[model samples]
Target: MATSVDKMSTDTQAESIYFLNAGAAQAEQDRLNRQHRLFDDMMQNDLLPPHVASALSALKTPPKILEVATGTAVWLTEVAKTLPLDAEFVGLDYDTTKFPSSLPPNITLRQADMFKPFSGDLLGKFDVVNVRLIIFALKEGQGTDLLLTSVEPPSQAWFRFQDINWRFAKKVGRDMNLPLSMVAYIKEAGCVDCDDKAYPGNSQLYTRGREDWISRTNVHVKALAEQSLRGITSLGGVEGMTTQKEVDELLACFDKEFEDRIVHYLFVRAWGRKPEAD
Candidate 1:
């Protein structure tokens, strides 16, 4: 399929798109893979529910699966391994630099900006569509709303929502947050039987270590802070909230305050199904 950048009303609007950098490309790729593993372990090795899995597996024809912002396509690749031989898997992202050089025969990777409309062929053509960790990238609710509108409603769609919830910790501190606006967005997009479950971040596989875990967790948190700063500044700069330099200083303070403070996050997995046609 032909994937291209989304159209903007003004050139300035088009030039301001920002992607949070987690160090170099390789580091970012590694982070994403680790993230996938963490979530997989947390979810008991099942990405989706048994009902959803059964739905896709029972399809007479080859089921088509689409993953949005599929960085490194790690989640898609793993899910592909459990599917039928004829299953077709597609992963889309704005940058393909991290996509595996070699992919399974059933899997396809494409470079596509999530901010824009999906290619016509991709509209309403998936049995399942998966999206994760995208809240920090788009402006407030813009990204989730846009993504929901762009994709053709599949038989099922699942979203993994993330937020830094310091309230769960014993210590008081600032944390990056994701609001519950996505629940409404899913319903507004005509999804039915919507449901969600929340999980603690520390419950993931990465948190199951001793001294080594502390060191690795520190690195992960620092990278996340940097990424969050970039996202906030990029969107805020467009809206005249703050400049990049100011964001840098504010993030430095945030880092200090966060030091030794109990870190906690909440991830919510939500799913819904499109109504069958009459």
Candidate 2:
């Protein structure tokens, strides 16, 4: 009786790798989160995919769904509402407190550490496991920054990001791991027939006048570097890698890079199935 978190759990090594290497990268990930929010727009525009909607509509017993790090359920609530009864959903995170209290009845949110193995008691089993935005935990040598097809021009934002994210990760002595691996991790935990998707994000559409993703994220990256380095040095945790002035320098460097072009956005989605008899 393994739980969903058992396989996809984020241990201290993983978290440490992310914070250590990514402690310098801020704007990129957060900005990406702000965009392509399908769930956020679901209630308003019925933006969910036709197949997902259809699948949900047919559910007699709500399909059991698991969402990892469901930030605000900006998507979960809509997913739950769109689905038929018996479509049970469980969202987990260390910060489950961030979940909105207005959650639908079919949806259950819990606060738990996902880094460990699963338990049959708490997590029944899942039909579809939805994982988003857990890339920060991958240490390195994962995949390229991200792979996505887009309609945008030759800004090559995605390629540049691949460099930056890996660059920073290497700096912290971590190998970049792709998010898709977590899906395999799920399968090894007894999930059957895992599914994964990497798609283009809605950033280009929303970023028309906002500048290409690289430029946009560059500013945020620089800011994040400055903030994190300053904080680290002030309290000084890992080592001397981060310091007030060092962070400031990193900010300026990123600012200059942003002024140039280095980093972009892409869409990615992955899912897997869990057996009921487990």
Runs with alpha carbons beyond 4 Å of true place in candidate 1: 1-18, 141-179, 204-216, 230-262
Error of 1 at 236 (Å): 7.9
- Tens-digit lDDT track of model 1 for 11-99: 32344344454236776787778767656765767787768999988898898999998989998988988887789999998766678
Best by TM-score: 1
**Per-prediction TM-score, please?**
0.69, 0.58
Each candidate's lDDT (Cα)? 0.61, 0.50
lDDT per residue as tens, model 2, 124-242: 56655666655654444332234432223333333343444445555555534455465666666776666655544344435443455544444544444444444334433243343
Task: TM-score for candidate 2, please give it.
Answer: 0.58
Clash total of candidate 2: 20
